[model samples]
Target: MTQEILRAEGLRKSFPGVQALDGVDLTLRPGEVHVLLGENGAGKSTLIKMLSGAHHPDEGRVLLDGQPVDIRDARTAQRLGIATIYQEFNLVPQLTVAENLALGRPPRRFGFVDTRAMRRQAAELLARVGVDVDPATPIAGLGIARMQMVEIAKALALNARILIMDEPTAVLTTGEVDRLFAIVRQLRDAGVAVVFITHHLEEIAEIGDRVTVLRDGRSVAEVAADTPQNELIRLMVGRPIDQQFPRRPAEVGEALLTVRGLSRRGAFDDVSFEVRAGEVVGVAGLVGAGRTEVARAVFGADRYDSGQVSVRGETLARADVHAAMRAGLGLVPEDRKGQGLVLGDDVAANLGLVTLRRATRAGFVDLRAQRRAAAKVAEQLAIRMTGLDQEVRTLSGGNQQKVVIGKWLVAEAGVLILDEPTRGIDVGAKVEIYQLINALTDSGRAVLMISSDLPEILGMSDRILVMARGRLVGELPAAQATQDAVMELAVTDVEASRVQ
Candidate 1:
């Protein structure tokens, strides 16, 4: 019989406003890859945080190799061989890769730190992840994908026996994801139990050996990875999600947005497209394909060398975010915490961000007006919290995303640009978002959606545009678009396509 490496029983946690987890239980065996699944408000993160010692459970017990242990803090958990890689990276940008890897336990000799020894250790860890990088390089100079690799190395260096990864592939390309899977397999072969948490269903089948479904802070079911896909999805969603994406009838109206000869130096170039009112135009491509960059340029977040963005035939100025807003455009960025929300604020406060002026009276803040407006959308989105005053940081990943989308919903713009809007969200939340998108178009608003998930793009888009490197390569009608076609365009090899 395989030995159980880690176990949590009757886990319970609560805050002033919400009971994040309630009587959750999980168990893992050595050399096994266990997947955790739930919808946005299902309490997956809260449970992981408790298991990793980021938060103490109000009630429950944790067992490591049949021994009960008291883990009050992250350091204690690390000492007990549990390493957690959160979705939001915790690396210091100013530090060198080697120094960051050996921050807490650097080798010391003769009252001096051993720099050569640190580099050797960092390099070996990087090699394990199939990443080749100079240990002397500063982390800030590295891209998001490379930084993720460094995080994996740091986790391994700690001799972690039970590793927890949250949304590990949210920022990786296909090739990088494959490389990561190989390392995960190696770890499992060496008897390291892994608790994998992801929004991608395909990954559960690809890397997971067993699956545990969580619903409203409880373990609903546990099964082998080979369990039928529809059955597993039903367990997590609490309903038969026969299809991940549901198509809506499209009525492409008058062109609401037109981008002509859009070019930005070293980012995107000569991109042109038209989005009609009551239509969704999907931008599909692999990572670094300039999909998000295009949305940024259109929304005036980045400067463009040459291009004309028009709403209802009126030209928009470059690098003018305020002007873009005035021209009836709203952008839901990919990086929610970094660019989407004020993490330290409450849900009502974040919801009032876009239209704060409207909620004020004669330069005096109107508390009632802000609450009334925020409460309406909060209810519409079904955001679960004690009240609107609850901190956004305490909410689940899906709830955080809802707040981000709620801001735009209240904006009521003529044009909406969403970048990876459904990423890291659970199946039920994704379905809600899809319905919301349909409502947006039904109300005569145009949507420019940038997503890496092919099913989302093909099912929701009235038309699709694919980009590779920095150039737009192909456009397909939603009826004709398929997973294979989008992949072809995203990974196409054209020498001139790479961005500088």
Candidate 2:
């Protein structure tokens, strides 16, 4: 029988305006992956923080091997064989891999720092996590996947018995995700208890041993890993999501946005596609396949060495974002927090950012007009918030995404380019976003969506375009597209350039 390594009972934590966690319970046994499922603000982060000693639960007891203990800080948690790998890594980028691994506890000889010993230990830890890199290599040079491996190595170096991975695969490619899962399974077999958190419902059956669902800051359900997907969705959002993708039939009018021979040297090359009015065009590819690069180039966020981007038969100037915006184009960037939304501002402020000039009257701002526009978009997108004045940073992931999309709606953009539109958001929010997409296309706007989710691409897209090695390799109508067909074009080379 497996032993329960960590247990939390009736965990309750409260911030000034929010009761982040209300009577949450969790039990993690050695040699099993316990998936923690919840929408953003459903208290998953709060529970994890409490478990990792970043926060103290108001009313709860945490047990280690059935013995009650006080976890006052991160240091204390680490000492007690618990470590957390957050979505955003905790590694110092300026430092070398070895230095980062031995951050708090460096090897010492005769009261002097022992660099050689530290490097040796770091090398061993890196190998254990299946990371192939020099110990002396700077952390800044490593990619997201490698950085994650380093984090796991650091945790293992600290002798962690209970590992908490919070959205570990959120930013990874398909291949990278598979490798990470292998490492996770290896750790589980070695008797490490892992608390995994993710927004992707498909990942549960792939790696999880058991599942726990949280709703409105409470533990709503716990089930076996093999539970049906619909039941899990029901427990999570308090309703059954019968249709995951709410796609309407494409109207397929004249091309609203056309890209011809679009090329960004070293990023993407000879990428060409057309998004018709009332149509949804999806760009699908593995990471580093230049899907995002193509989107950015078309939107004028990045310079394209060679290309013609024409909207309604008018050619746009190269690398000019203002021109793109003025030509009825808007891009919801992949990095929503960094490029999409101004997190420090309130909902009204962010919603009005793209349309501020229109809301201005002869050197004076119209607050009423801004608020009205914000209110209209907020209602259209069903953005859940305390008020229009609520800071964007404090909102949930789904609501934050809505605000980003809502900005374009307020801008009256005719062409919308969305990169990773449904990434890192919950199922309920995904459905809502899909409904919004359908609404947009139904209203005769063109949508060019770049997504990693296969089902999303197949369901919402009128036609799917696949990229490989920075080139458009294939295209398929939605009726003819399958996961296998898309994956083939995404990864492998084809003799012919396009798939009609």
Candidate 3:
């Protein structure tokens, strides 16, 4: 039997107005991958922070090998063989891989840094994690997958016995995810306890050994990794989710948004499609397949080298974002935090952003009008928050996404463009977003969506458009679109070229 290396008993934490974690207990055994599953505000982050010494539990005893220890700080946690790799990497982008590996503790000889020894050690660590990049390469130049491998290497460098990974595969491609799983398995075989946190339910079966579900600041269920996905979802949300996608049937109307021969040199080429009113058209593709580029071009976020974009039979001027907005087009961007919301601003302010022109009067802002508009949108989206004055950055991932969508709703956009609308949100929140999409389409609004999750594209789209390399390769009705067919069109040059 494997030894239990770390244990938490009755962990409790509280914030200003939230009980972040309440009586949450967890046990980690060496040579096992224990998955921590939860929704956006389910106390997962709070528990992880306590374990990693970022926060102190209000009431709990943490045992390391049967001995109680107080992890006072991050350095103390490191010394106790506990390392955490957060979703947002901590590495300095300006530094080289080797430099980042030896960030705090570089090799020293006679009070001087031993650069050669540091590089050699960094290379060895990278090799252990199966990362095949030069140690001298800058971190900014590497993709998300390679950077994740480097993070693992850094943890190994610290001799971490318990590794905590928070949403490690959130930004990785399918192939990259496979490689990461291989490395994780290798670490497990080598007797390292891995605590993996993710919103993607499918990953539990793929890489987890044991699973723990947290909901509303409490640990609700603990089971083996082989537990059915439906049971896990029930445990996480406290009820069975009948439908993952709440798609509704809508009559397709005349084309509200149309693209013809849209070309962005080196990004996408001759992408032609139409999103009719009262329908959701999903663009499916692999990473770097120009799905986002196509969406950006049509929305006027990015300038296209050539092609025409028309809204309701009227041609739009190229590279004009204001024109697109005036024509009743709205975009819920992919990077929601960075591009969608003003993090420092309050919920009311963010919701009133796109509709500021309408809310303003006599060259002065009308706070009362803005508040009313924001309240209406919040009620429509069912956004849970302390109040409209609460900072958007303080809200959960799902709530932040709602704010992004609510901005467009307040703007009264006729055609909406959603890029990875539910990318980092939880399953429960995803269902809510899908229901919102249904409501939007039912109101005779058009939607053009770009998504990498095959299940999402299959479930929500009225018609699926497949993109490969830099072009629109194939189109299929949602009823006839299977995962296999989408994959074939997304990756195979022969089939894609023939269809194009």
Candidate 3 lDDT score relative to the true structure: 0.89
Residue 117 Cα positional deviation in candidate 2, in Å, after optimal superposition:
6.8
C-alpha lDDT score of every prediction, in listed order: 0.87, 0.89, 0.89
The 10-residue segment of model 3 with minimum total lDDT is 491-500
lDDT of 2 by residue, 409-478 (tens): 9999999999989877888888899999988998999999998778889989989999988988899999
Question: What's the lDDT for candidate 2?
Answer: 0.89
**TM-score (all chains, Cα) for each model:** 0.94, 0.91, 0.91
- TM-score for candidate 1, please give it: 0.94
- Local lDDT at 235 for model 3: 93
lDDT of each residue in 82-119, candidate 1, tens digit only: 99988888799999999989988998879799999889
Model 1 RMSD vs true structure: 2.4
Q: Give candidate 1 regions above 4 Å deviation.
A: 107-110, 114-120, 132-137, 358-361, 496-500
Residue 87 displacement (Å), model 3: 2.2
- CA displacement after TM-score superposition, residue 192 of candidate 3 (Å): 0.8
